[model samples]
Target chain A: MIMTTTAQATKTAPTTTPARSIARLLLHGGTVFALLALIVFFFAMRPDVFLTFVNVKNILFQVSILAIIAGAQTVVMVVGDFDLSVGATSSLAGAVAASLMLTGVPIAIAITVALGVGLLVGLVNGILIAVVNLSAFVATLATMTSVVGLAYLVTAGTTLFDLPDGFNNLGQGRLLNIPLPVYFAIVISFILWGALRFTTIGRRWHAIGGNVEVSRLSGVNVRRARLLAFTIAGLVSAIGGILLAARLGSASAVQGGDNMMFSVAAVFLGMTVIKSGASNLGGTMIGVAIIGVMSNGLNILGVNAYVQQVVTGLIIIAAVTLSSLKTRQR
Target chain B: MRIKFKIAALAAATALSLSGCAASASSSDNGKPLKVIAFTSGNQTPVGAWWVKAVTSKAKDLGWDLTMIQGDFDFQKMNPAVESAIGRGADVILDGYTDIASIGSIVSAAKDANIPIFAMDSSTKETDGFAVNITTNQQQIADATVGALAKTLGDLKGKTVMVIGHDPHPGIRMRADLAKKALIAAGATIAGDDIQKVKSPASGRTEALALVADYLSAHPNGLDGVWVGWDDAALGASKALSEAHSNAKVTGVDATSEAIAQIKAGGNFLATIEQPWPKILDKLVQNVSAYQKDRTLPKTKFEADDTTLVDSSNAANITPSDKLG
Candidate 1:
């Protein structure tokens, strides 16, 4: 009986290997394939405009701020926690920076204070979850609401305009004809990717997310790691908010709050590519790119905004479903 | 000793209760200041901010005990605050820059409390919830803006234009539809065969910039004119045209400071419509003060004020709407 079973297993191994390889390819390459397909499809539809250099640059420029915020989200998500306050933090930080400048505070000082605010919000979130034992969702949600209220208070329930030109240059200025925010997005994405891929702290965060008990057994400071994750997310989100205010030449109390949902969507779209199904910076960037392409392509084709929104919803669902199925298979 | 302490506490409580009743009774007396509940969900917009400042100043001048509520576009927060204020008792309410549809429950609550509610730009057509709804005539505004665009383009026949709008805003929705119809009737083709709807007012500038830039990328000479529902988005469209070096003249409503500056600078911003918000507020205040003097309501349930067309000729003369306060 043992000999016969061994013979049969060997007989199936050859055929099953190819099948598994195909499945793996489909699971890991789905987002990339979709992104490529979208580009090709849009290019075919509008041969005169879709793949042009200017349009591509426009897509990058449009997604830059989202990329920064989404990158911040990816950091928190990797540690098996969500920073729901990112968007609110962004709005508050931007409003603070702008309000400070209006009140005659030096631009650099104002920006530093705004970043400090973001860090402070993150620390509070960290303490709530890591030290106080509150669930991440509840803790961040509470902070998000409070932060938004603070944003309204800071701006006096209005949009803040007439920011200094020197500060606006940070958002609007160009390097060789490309917008400055785009460079910030690229640089920040790279730094996040590197940190996640290499540092010991990054490894510990991944371990804690994978299994907290095992991570603790392995001597990792699980609480401190999680706290660090929330703190980093807050700081990065603040950077994104400041850039957004500069880019728009104005800041409203709820302006950066709109980025929250899109950041989550981008992160979810990005998670499909990793075999481990872990949230990753590369995947998030790809996710952000997919959204930017879809929106830009649809607009170029003159599709209705409502219909475009629906299509985006469907794409996110499909990508997430694929990732979920792959995880279940594992 | 405990019984004596309790008796003293009871006496103190009774004295405080009497004082509270006296304060409450004074607010309702005919000779006292008019207790007003003023609120809006759109306090973040430029016009909405203007309304807030203007109403506060007006209330102070009128010596009305005002309970100002800033919704910041959150109905969940604004509604409850308004309801609580109503529960506390008020002589009248002022709904500024908030759509009636969003304040239905608040209106019903105010009605139950027997308080009259006055509104400014709450709806395109007069709705039943408000005692008086005064807004700019969206159709007339569209007519004037489209005419300006046509004149700038020298002719509308065979010209291509884009009408951008946000549907959630009643006034913008109505005027955008009217503008599209007027554009087509004048033989101009609507770009993409429809209006480009913006998802959020907060991000209107970037979205508008992308729309114009992408459309121009595909059709280098295809766009001749753009009519945006608001100035923020129109300024974005103008910026895109400048970048593309396209002579596509843009028209916007709400002659904002940025739009006025652009118009004066002689770029693609052709004209903007300045709704008489200050004038409308003045009229609403007069009626409210009259009602405070004696129980009275406006003669009409709804009123649409005439809007001015601020082209380069008048752009310099008109005060920007953001600074209207």
Candidate 2:
């Protein structure tokens, strides 16, 4: 009788779940729909310039840095932590990498060192939040301030220049008519998606975030999971810094600071999409694309740049609020 | 037991309160000096350094306490900095205006407070409420740099020259437009066909390096001379070209230390238009001092300095570093 009851419960669960999931889909799916509408509208308005091959390529290239940073931000947020330091870390990594290249260091060695610096910063954040018992918000904010100061100190508050020709190619070169940075983003996103969806470590992260005390009682090694999440975030952010430096062909203290908040906003807005309240890699890609398209579209339409920022902020807030309401109802 | 706990809590609270008060008092009472506020943007740049030096040097001479506020090139921050200076009863305000339109509210507020503001570097035409607008004649500087570049190039009739600068900066844009006009009038063909627009780098150094590399790769033989809208841009371009082993002659406005050094290094930077900031700052201070002594001192717009073309021969004579606000 117990076996029969279990079978019945399983059979009913599938049927009931679809209805609830459909509502969630609408809540999350609306952002993608809106993005598509905006793209079509802009294309129709300025078919000549907006839909050109070069412009499309340019949009992807421009959005690559923002997308990579936003992807890391998603992972940080999934673990119920915020990383305000990602932007500063990116700038530090880029500045250090460019300075190394300017000093005739090999590109590969400079990249490795840059990634190591990012990891060290991440470890500091993880220790502060997990061991010292400080809130991630406050801990990351402190790190952000210090990292910016360190970047400024490293560069002596000046832009590093005269990078080798090879480094400039990273910004200007194209393979099969697609930008190198775009390819980098795609490869990173694939690995991130696999880790988040199929790995045991991913489960642990979700469990710890869902309920920290419960996971600890369950012997889930919550501290390790949290640390790993942050470490991964740091590694990805450093990669973003490297690509940004390559694209700019030089690095300065303020290189990536402007993109930090926007990246976070993109990640938050991503959570409101097809995955509903859940942070998913696919959702992040869509979120990044939406932002990229809108920005490019507005630029093509000749709308004021400042007005575009205002519109983007308002749309992100609205989408997230709607998703939050749906989650509460469920 | 409860009374003992309460006593301990009270003692801790008292200690905290006393420490807080002590910290506040020390910070507030370090000096009761007259406050003079100076506002500019981007602490890392040479311009920021020049402004700080000029303001502090003048303040020292007048025996007034100076507070330097960085606006980060945001006009939004400039308004609040001015308001706060007024709240602090600041004796004088020295500010850089990003745009003439953005300073209307700040100017009106300063007028209401009866505080004299000395506009530096950039200014608005609305001098009715301000003390003085002391600016380097940017149009003249642009024309001089282009003219110098044309002379060096020798028959720029069919040669393509690239003009690089920041278009959002009004002063920079004004100078760039003037230079373009001057170049065209001199029979030089501007490179506006392919990558003709001013390519501003996300960062100055990157822009400079990319520009040099890209320009050289595209034009191997080096067409006409390259004209930069600013000295720093020229310096960056020079660094890139030097690294690439290219001999493209470059010219720019603003005889900054780096630009002069590049010229001295024989990196193909022919000349730069020099603005003597020290002399300009003295004129600014003189105007402000006169206004303070007598409110009726005639409100006047002073063209503080004209641009001079400094090449390798004369670059050595120009002071590489001087305090200018």
Which candidate comes out best when scored by DockQ? Answer: 1
TM-score of candidate 2's A chain against the true A chain: 0.91
Question: How many clashes in each structure?
Answer: 1, 1
lDDT, model 1, position A113? 99
Give per-residue CA lDDT, model 1, range A213-308, as digits (tens).
999999999999999999999999999999988987777678767689889999999999888877999999999999999999999888888899
Using all chains and alpha carbons, the TM-scores for the candidates as numbered come to 0.88, 0.68
Candidate 2: deviation at residue B184, Å? 14
What is the lDDT, from 0 to 100, of the residue B166 in candidate 2? 71
Residue A24 displacement in candidate 2 (angstroms): 6.5
lDDT of 2 at B76: 81
Tens-place lDDT digits, model 2, residues A205-305: 77776678898899998888888888888788888887887776667777767667877778766777744376767777878888878876764443544
lDDT of 2 by residue, B1-325 (tens): 9999999999999898676544432332455444567776645555566667667777898866787787655668767886777666555677754454567776677665556677766652444545666777877787777777777777778777767667666667677777778778878766533222333333454445444444444344454667777766776666556544666577877666666766887767888877766676777777756654543443465444575778877988887542233
